[model samples]
Structures are given as C-alpha cells and as structure tokens.
Target: MRRLPLLLLPLALAACNGGTGTPVTIDVKSDDGDNGSFRMENGTVSIKGDGFQGNFRVPQIKMKADDVDLDGVKLYPKSEIAGFHITGGDKPGNGKDGGKDGSKGGGKDDGKVRIDFTSPASLAAVQNWFRDGFTKKGFTFASRGDGFAGTTSDGGTFTLDLSADGGQKVKGRMEMTGS
Candidate 1:
C-alpha cells in the first residue's frame, strides 16, 4: 500500500443552520458488498459487522462545515481493531533528520478510503447530495463509464459507485484516493 501525498484537495461540505446539526446514520451496505451498519446517534456511533462489533461515543462535535473545510466533520473510532476507520495511515519515511513519525509504522498504509453505505434516500437524491456537496467546495466532476469521477481543486481524486437497492434505499461506494 502507498501513502497519498498531502495536497490541497478541493472538496467541501455545507453547514447546517444550528450548531447541533442533524446527526446522520450510515448503513454500511453497498451495491457490491455489505460491510454492516453504523448508527451514529446522540454522541456515540455503534458498529456491527459480519466478523466484528464495537461501539464508541463521539466527542461533543459542534462541527460546522465551511466551503473549504475538509475535516469539518470528523469520525473518531475507538475500536482497537484495525481498518475500522477510513483513510489508513501513511508509511514511515526514511530521513536523516527523522522527519516522519516512526511510531506510525506497521499500520495500514493504503492510500484509499473506501466506504459502502445505504440510506432511505432516493438514488437521485443521494447523487445530487454528493454532487452538490462537493462541487460547492470546488471539485470538478465528470460522468464516467463506471460511475462518477471527481478531482479536487488540488488534483486529489475520488470515485463514486452508486446504485439503487430496488427499494427506496440508495447504495453507494465512495473510494477516496488523495494526496
């Protein structure tokens, strides 16, 4: 696995009205695979998967999204197991000055964040949700043969594979590979 270089990726999220915005429940199921379920409520998020289970309360988050704030919303996973959170760690660097954090080695270094999830929202609504959300933060997107591809203002790239689950649920896979 490679580490994505840190760049000025252009992606965005919008801020809701109140300080305590509407909390979202993410169903961890996808069109191609099913991871499990993630219920984010009150201040804690509970995870249930095929071979793993864990629960942790989120810190008090008064996060308000800015047009250019990539970390406006944050997810802090408390599970000891690896791969629970998105965006694995970067590989340690070899430097004379020891610029890299050596303690971060031996962890997942895949330069990708893959999330599969479903919601009761319609496919169109879900599509528009991402489309509008990212474009506002300055990501240029185009429809691809596989799905929708987008590049951030700083050239970071991501792909979205989405499908309707035949019910009202919209299923999607979000793979983010960025520098």
Candidate 2:
C-alpha cells in the first residue's frame, strides 16, 4: 500500500507543473508521518507547502517598501521588498508581472497589496517588528504555528511568514487587504 502512494506521487506532482515547461522541483522531507515539509522551486517562485508560504523573485521587477503604501505599518529595519503586486487603486506595477499592464502609473491606496521580502534580521526579530508595528496601528496580531496574522479595526488584514535561509538571513512574504 505504501508503494501505491509512491507510484501516484509523480502524477500528483505533474498536475502542479501546469505545463509551463519552466521546470518545477519539489523536495519533501518528513520527520514523522504528519510533521514534514514540502518545498517547490519553479523558476522565480518558491513555495513551502506546510505553511502555505512562498515568495516570487523576478529580476525585471524593481520595487521598494516606499513604493507601496501599507497604511502606517513599517517593515523591519533594512528589509528589502523583493517583489510586490498591487491592484484596486492607482498603484504601480503588478507583483506577478512587473507592470505588464503597460502603465507606468500611480494611484491612490486601494488597501490591497502583496509583498515578498528578505531581511538580514532573524526570523524571530522580523516577527516581533511586524507584531509591534501592527498592534500600535490598532491591528490585532496573533501568532500561528508558522507565522503571524492580524486585522485592522476597519477590516484590513495582514499576514506574515518568514523562514530561515540556511544562513544569517530570512526570506518571507506579507500580504495586506482592505483600506
């Protein structure tokens, strides 16, 4: 029976490829039966399935934290916004395609943004910084098994997740929705 699952694995994975021909690689390691990880690297996108966390890195897309408005929330000191996507307002560029809409435009806050970033700081520090910033802004923040989530008084929501990068840095992604 165990071998049946192993045989079916390829089929399951093939469905994930989406026929992009971009080449997808997945690595899964489990300590027990339930506690394990699933990681996939496909071109510029990397995902960790255990926690539903991932980030996309594209060379053509250029951005900074200042370029997008996250209300009054602040990012960790020296953190870099590696990729972003904004819609619903006059925001610049798409996080998935780098302004593929052919508009070098700017707009008002539509209260929706997805940001992927890297921080030289440790994972714990990054979480603390966001928790502090959001709470002060009146957002209720709580820790999940993998990361943190919060919501604003007016219906805004924020999510954060960071994983160690096998070195001194951490890579993470954050998303906010609602104005």
Candidate 3:
C-alpha cells in the first residue's frame, strides 16, 4: 500500500503542467511492446492497460516563493520561480549525482525536489546568500564542479547552482533530497 504513492509520484510529476480543467487523452507505446493510455482531466489522472491502472490527483505546486518549502532551504532574494518538480526515492538511483559509471552513491533519501528560478541579482550575490543561509541553518557546504552541495545535520542534502543569464539576471536551480 505504501508503494502506491511512491509509484504515482513519477506519473504525477511527469504529467503535471498545471491543470486546465479540460480532458485530454495520451496514448503511450514503448519499444517493449507495452502500451497504455493516460487520461488527465480536472487535476486527476486515470490510467488503463499496461497493468498500471488508477486515478490520482496531481499534486499542485505553489509558484509563490513564500509557499515553497525545501526543508530549511531558502531561495535567493527577488528570485522568480520558473519551474518545480519532485521525484520519489522508490524510482531508483540517486539524485543527479548518480555517476556516469553507474554508481548510485548520493542523496539516499526519501525523495528529491528541485526548483528553477531567475533573479535580477549578481551571481556572486546569490551564491553568498545561500552560503550564509545554509551555514546559519547548520548545513556544511562543500564545493562541487558546477556549484556547491550542502548536507544538513539530519542527513538531508541540497545543491545550488547559479549562472549569469545576461544583463543583471542570474538563473539558478536548487535541488533538495532527503527526510
């Protein structure tokens, strides 16, 4: 019974595009000769065939920054959220850190959530903001190839990467996985 929600998380996260209250049918066919249809309507998804059948309400993600929570993770000031999504742990492998050598060695937690945003602040400023905030929250930070990684006292993990988006805007992504 517990696995049901975990299994549904991928489907919900994949199909969610902000419901429009209109019904739509999607036929899915794979090279393995397995096929099925997914019907989405009014914030609900129904599946048929392929041995995966059920109806689940797609979880709504809040676009407002104040309503978003990534444990104690904080978004950069004046950031405008562009996208958000989550993946359950049961899906296998680790977070994006799963290596190219097929080694699953990072973020062994219950789930992972990511938020994409842009801010009209300098890249250095954004990095400093997160560094200060995470440090104050008892997270130890380490530099990564692309950005930085932090681990909380409770074993949760988070990563932040920011790059200039031309002019004064900076684009970034924050991913958290654990507890």
Best by lDDT: 3
**TM-score list, all predictions:** 0.43, 0.49, 0.57
- Flag clash pairs in model 3: none
Worst 10 residues of 2 by lDDT: 30-39
lDDT for residue 89 in candidate 3, whole number 0-100: 34
Q: Report lDDT (CA) for all predictions.
A: 0.45, 0.54, 0.62
Instruction: Quote the positional error of residue 116 for candidate 1 in Å.
Output: 1.2
Winning model by TM-score: 3
Q: Over the stretch 92-140, how does candidate 3's per-residue lDDT look in tens digits?
A: 2344655335657464455567777887777777778777777787788
Model 1, TM vs. native: 0.43
User: How high a TM-score does candidate 2 get?
Assistant: 0.49
Candidate 3 regions exceeding 4 Å error are 1-62, 91-110
List all candidate RMSDs to the true structure: 12.4, 15.9, 8.7
